[model samples]
Target: MTNYNELTVPEATLIQKQLRDNIKVTPYNGPLNYIAGADISFNKFSTTVYAGIVVLEFPSLKPVGYSLVKKEVLFPYVPGFLAFREVPALMDAWTQLPVKPDILVVDGHGIAHPRRMGIATHFGVLTQQPTIGSAKKKLFGNYEEPGPEKGNYSPLTDRQGELLGYALRSKNKVKPIFVSPGHLVDVPGSLDILLRCIKGYRLPEPTRLAHNAVNQFRLNEISEGWTSLL
Candidate 1:
């Protein structure tokens, strides 16, 4: 078990090193009948966090199961150690999921980080599930701009020229998203999944739905609390 509370930056870095070794980048030939997306959002002007998981039936991309959990922020926001700040709350929501997804898509980076371990990797390792990192921005690495067409991609490479992920064009004439294997999945698999999940949006359906879910939940909670106080 990994410690999730009261750790220094050095300790966190050490843990990341151990967790990075456990990540497996391979193709998942198993049936992906169900896919899920996990994401977290913070309350406005507060440290309270809402984590959400949205499951969608694969190929068809229909909604199946969803879960959300709220937690007081425990860890501070650190540049490379975002997992510590967010994963705990995400786990709270993940445990409430009734249907375990065949693969997970996280709204963050994977190996495309300074430490080769990101929030997506942490979630995948803890859950022991195949996970993909589909990030809105590039956290690290350099890559040429992908072609201005949906499904086109360019390799994202580290300073050492090792390929870490891809800059994927999910929509035509739009900025690309960064993608990498979190665990139990490879670059090719990641690309395939992302392209399938995209439905004419900058983000995939699973993640976009989850993002909406958590935000709506937060709004409802805050509104209800305010009304009760009136």
Candidate 2:
């Protein structure tokens, strides 16, 4: 992976804008062989990235192959620049997979960013894969509350009156998850996949598994007395 830190502000900003402008918002109507999620856990010194791929029997969400990868973090964590710190380890983990996933679900913002290029956007552009961004919290944008029921969602718009994505209620009465197109997928298509993946949970199954996988590594590191470098 190349160091994005080497790029000047103008260069990076231009690159980000180009990506956002050229994004494909087409509906994702492809085969769903596998659904994967990527997440990261970091101590002060090392960061472990875990990507879990579940090969579901088309339309039936079931796990088949699962793998993980952990590596030391090379970049420091900076707000709005998390992709630089996290994508290296993530790409390492992703490339290690023997069975590539059909759709990737990321745990961060997509177009809902100051630069309109969040971690999900960066990963999708770099890999040219079908990806979606689902966040636990809002990064930027304004939206009305979704209906007090599952499957209800509303558009999340930016300051310039552009639709970024949707704030969706995955589970009844639970907190809504922010959904956005990372790449080949559109906002509606991303939300559809998320809803299909939800089995009465706040998070989709693939993402929940990935989150647990990464947190497990974090727990093990903490128990081993590894000094935090974050």
Candidate 3:
């Protein structure tokens, strides 16, 4: 794993630039039976990362199997450098899964970042798996508001006017979520999968479940007197 703390500013910038320059924005046509989501929660004493994989009956979006892992954190949070703090533990959790997932839905940014290498991108590159970023808020990008109806979406472009992804409305009147390509998937393809995964919810089922799982784990840890770091 690349250590963010050890890299010089120039080196980090170069690495990020390389990542963006080499990013592949293409449609994915491989098997997508198993889709997974990963998330993390931090405490003053530790961080808990969770990854949940669900096998859907291709195009039907049904659950088959799921798994999660939690570990004590050893790194601190840093903005625009979050992959370093979170990806390690998330990788550990991912490796524990009995079956490899076809698509990974991470609860963070992908190309919609200052470096275009968010948690989803980093994990996808490391695992060499197709992944999508479904974030609850915009990390970087500009777009007009989507329609109030479900399934409506608007483009989310970066400062340089590059098409990053889409801000999609999964439910009527609910806040839209940002969808972006992580790896092996284009912006439109990412949005398509996100829409398929939404079963009348604000977020996709896999991501929503993973978020809930991590938050619940963190809440339990806090109830047990663990101090929160983030």
Candidate 4:
């Protein structure tokens, strides 16, 4: 495992470059038994981080299991280096999963980043798993606002005119969500899966469930652990 906190910005940037080569941007064609969402939460200026991963049954989107980890994160919340602060705890939760999901939906950017190494992309590379980034705001790239209808999307492109992801309206009249491929998946493929995971909300089921779960866990004062709902 990488010493996430011990590295300087330059070292982290280099690591990102090396890991970029490991990313295989292909269409998602794996098993559909399960899909997971990961999220991290903490109070303002607090080092106590709460990380959660919620696994749902494919197609049904029903929760089957979850893992939680609370740790003191020393890394500051840098806009681009969020994975350095969160992935360590997220991976701790990942290891405790009795059964791993076929894909992960992370609440951050993916390849749609300045260095092509967003939290989703970073985590996917570490685990060698297919992951998608479902962010609520734009981090990198430009696109026209999508139509104010469910499932409408506009192409997101970089300055070089290279396709990055899509700005999708998951629900009618709601703000668009940025969908991007993290690793082992392409731009369209990422959006395709996110469309299926939507449940009439701004955020998709997998990530929404996680976002809610982690916040609740923190509120309830839960500790680091894993639970099986299967």
Candidate 5:
């Protein structure tokens, strides 16, 4: 793994371009038994980052295992460089998870970025897992807004007309979310998994659960006055 904080902005951008060449969009061929979601939150006025992971049984979407880790934020927020800021802590949280998932769903982009090295793709490479990105908003690519009905989707494509992701409507009459393959997963597989994971919500269960868990952990830390200079 690259030492994200050690690299300057220009170096990081170059690394992303190189990493994009390594991304594989093959579909996951193994049994879809377990799926995981990952998210991160920050403590107020501090560089403290709280990362959370939730593993759920496939189809049922019932939470079977979860983990959280708090660590000093290592990278500053930069557009198109979110993985550098959040992935290290998420890796810590992933280590604490009791059950390893067959597939991971992240709360960010996959190939739907300028260089196609979104947080989900970055994590997938390091973990060597089939992963998908289900982001609340589009970060790159051009697409028509998906229809309001549930499951409606429009292909998100780059200027060259290569598919990058999809504008997916996870719920009826609600705004669409962006779905993209991270690694070892194809675009169709990504959308299928996300739709199955949806439970009357705009976000899929895995990411929704992870988002809730990380925010709760951050709230607890703040309330308990946990602080470090870092």
Candidate 6:
């Protein structure tokens, strides 16, 4: 595993460039028994990070289990290198998970980055999991606004017109969510899984549940370990 800490921005950029060759893009067509979402939370003035991964049953989207971790991060906040600051805590939480999910929905970008190395891709490379980025904000791609209805989407491409991901309008009247393939998955697979997880909310059930879980873990001072909801 690469060292999570003790790296300059230039060194991080170099690493990103190297990891691009290792990212595999294949459409996932197997039956999904479970799916999960990963999220991280922290204050602007603190190095402490709260990471959580929530697992839900496929189709039903019922909460089955979750893993949470609170740790003091060592790396400084950087624009594109956020994985260094938050992935370590998430890895810790992953270790505590009872069962692994079929695919992970990350609260950040995947290949939709300047060097095609976003947090989701970084984590997927380390853990070798199928991950999809479901970000609230766009980082490095241009796309037309999706139609003002559920399930409408538009292609997100780079300056050279290379396909990266999609801008999906998850809910009516709300801003679209950016979806990108991380690893072991293709653009169609990423969007298909996310579209199935939507439940009348802007964010999908997996990520929305994960975002809520981490915030509760931080605010309510919940324990940092596996908490099965089953």
> Residue 101's C-alpha lDDT in candidate 4?
95
- In model 1, what are the clashing residue pairs, if there are any? none
| Candidate 2 lDDT by residue in tens digits, 56-119 | 3335666554455666554556667677767776787677666677998888977777877888
RMSD of each: 4.5, 5.5, 5.4, 1.2, 4.6, 1.1
* Model 5 agreement with the true structure over 1-230: per-residue lDDT tens digits: 56677878898899888777789999778999989899988866788888888888898998876788888876798889999999998888877765679999999999899988999998898888889998988889999988889889999999999998899988998889999999989988888888899899998999998898788888884322221211
- My TM-score estimates for the predictions, one after another, are 0.92, 0.84, 0.84, 0.96, 0.92, 0.96
- Runs in model 2 deviating more than 4 A are 4-15, 18-22, 44-58, 220-230
User: Over the stretch 118-213, how does candidate 6's per-residue lDDT look in tens digits?
Assistant: 999988988999999999999998999999989999999999998999999999999999999998999888998889999999999999999999
Query: Would you give me the overall lDDT of model 1?
Result: 0.85
lDDT of each: 0.85, 0.74, 0.75, 0.90, 0.86, 0.90
Q: What are the per-residue Cα lDDT tens digits for candidate 3 across 1-230?
A: 67654665567667777666667768999877778777776665545444333334446666555455565544556666677767777777777666677888988888888878977887787788888999989988899999999999999998778899999998999999999999889989999888889988898988876676667666663222112121
Model 5 TM-score? Answer: 0.92
Error of 2 at 210 (Å): 0.4
Tell me how many clashing residue pairs each candidate has.
0, 4, 5, 0, 0, 0
Extract clashing residue pairs from model 4.
none
Count of backbone collisions in candidate 6: 0
Query: Candidate 3 has what TM-score?
Result: 0.84
Question: Which regions of candidate 4 deviate over 4 angstroms?
Answer: 221-223
- At residue 25, candidate 2 shows an lDDT of 62
Per-residue lDDT of 1-230 in model 1, one digit per residue for the tens?
Answer: 45566889999999999888888888889898989888888766788988888888899888776787788876788888899988988887777776688998998998788988988888898889898998999999999999998989999999999988999999999999999989898878888887899999999998898898788878874321101111
